[model samples]
Target: MPKLWNETIAEHRRTVREATLETTAALVAEHGLASVTMSQIAKETGIGRATLYKYFPDVESILAAWHEGHVSAHLEHLTRIRDRAGTPGERLAAVLQAYADITHERPQHTEIAAVVHRGEHLAHAEQHLNALVRDLITDAAQAGDIRDDVAPAELASYCLHALGAAGSLPSKAAVHRLVAVTLAGLNLSPSTPDAAGGDD
Candidate 1:
């Protein structure tokens, strides 16, 4: 086949696959995971059952793919926030705020969120996020904006754990408050302005 034809075919396949994943996720959200089926996804996606099967073996696989895509997008978003022009502390705060917003405004249903978070993609994403935060913390500490007594990795984990409460917050303000609290834990204290604060 001509290269142009091959590219077109690949693009078509990508479009179909994205549509299928989106439709499946929407159906699952609306009907609950257990109530969704392959046929329903096929119909909702406007694709034949066989065609849907070519992309995904079953609902679980489709959901997994969707979850992976979601996580990849989120990571990319965080990366952008991290790369923005700002002080290390400011950039870290922006990323933390964005993450907290994601939790506050979770797009997936409860069941889907639970299932997707249990997947390997989430574990890897968490690691990537942790590393990103750790780097930020290291920079901030070096700049004297954050406490440096403990390891950056340990502070990163603490930030993640503390900010996780954003998922249960009732409003965006509450999410921002949670991020503020999490960040405060890493901030240099006023009284001990020159003290390198971290767990010994």
Candidate 2:
């Protein structure tokens, strides 16, 4: 086939795949995940069942692909936040806050969230996220902004585990407060006199 023809075919396939993923997700959200079917997806996506099968073998596979795309987008977003101009501590705080916001604002597809997190892609994305935060923590500790008593990797884990509560918080303000408390725990500065009971 000609090069232009090949490129055009690839783009068309990409468009079809995107449409299928979006339609599948919407169906799964509106009707429960267990209640969705490949036939329904094909009808809603406006693609033939054979074409849908060419992209995904089953509904579970389609959902997995959708989840993977969601996670990749999130990781990319966090990477952009981390790369923005700022001191190491400032960048770290920004990343943490952005992560908490993601947790708070993520779609409330309980079943999908539970199933998706169990996938290997999530594990890899988590490792990538951990490394990003660990590098920032190392920078901050070297600058005396965060305590150096613990390893940066350990501190990164602590930050992630602490901020995970944002997913269940009642409001965005609660999520921000949680981020503040998590960051406070990482601070290296001495406690204020008032916080120390004023020279008791």
Candidate 3:
């Protein structure tokens, strides 16, 4: 096949796949996980059942694909937030706040939890998130903005676990308060220079 023809076919397939994934997720969310079927996904996506099958074998597979995309997008977003210009402490705080916000705003459906929790993708994403926070903590400690008495990896784990509570919080204000408390736990010791913003 000509290069242009091959490119067009690839693009078309991508579009169909994305549409099917999106349609399946929406249908499942509306009708519940077990109630959604391949036919429903095809009809809602405006694609044929056969075409949908070429991309995904079952409703569970489609949900898994949709969740993979969602998790990948979230990781990319967190990476962008972490890479932005700021003091180590400031960037760390922003990333933690963004993470808490995402957790707080995520869908609370058990079906979603079921799909997202069973994949190796989740483990890999968790590792990436842990490293992102760990490195930030190390930098903040080096800059004297965060306490150095504890290991960075331990503090990173603590931050993640503590922020996980945001999912159950009743309000955004409460989420912010949670993040503030998590950050405060990393504060420098009172005897440290500039700990109280005193003059040199």
Model 2, residue 117: C-alpha shift (Å): 2.5
Candidate 1 local Cα displacement, residue 37, angstroms: 1.2
- Screening candidate 3 with a backbone cut-off below 3 angstroms (N, C-alpha, C), the clashing residue pairs are none
RMSD of each: 6.3, 6.5, 5.7
Local distance difference test, candidate 2: 0.84
Q: What is the lDDT of residue 131 in candidate 2?
A: 98
Instruction: List lDDT for all candidates, in order.
Output: 0.81, 0.84, 0.84
What stretches of model 1 exceed 4 Å from their correct place? 1-7, 188-200
Q: What is the lDDT of residue 192 in candidate 1?
A: 30
Candidate 2 local lDDT, 1-200, one digit each (tens): 13334567888788789989999888988998889999999999887899899899998788888989988998999899989886777788878888988888888788777767778998999999999999999998988878899999999999999998998899977887787789889983432323522110
The residue-by-residue lDDT of candidate 3 on 70-143, one tens digit each, is 88898899899999987888888878888998899988778877876898888999999999999999999999
Clashing pairs in 1: 149-197, 149-198, 150-198
lDDT (Cα, tens digit) per residue for candidate 1, span 109-171: 778877777788788998999999899989989988789999999999998888878877888
Q: Judged by TM-score relative to the true structure, which candidate is superior, 1 or 3?
A: 3
How would the candidate models be sorted by TM-score, starting from the highest? 3, 2, 1
TM-score result, candidate 1: 0.87
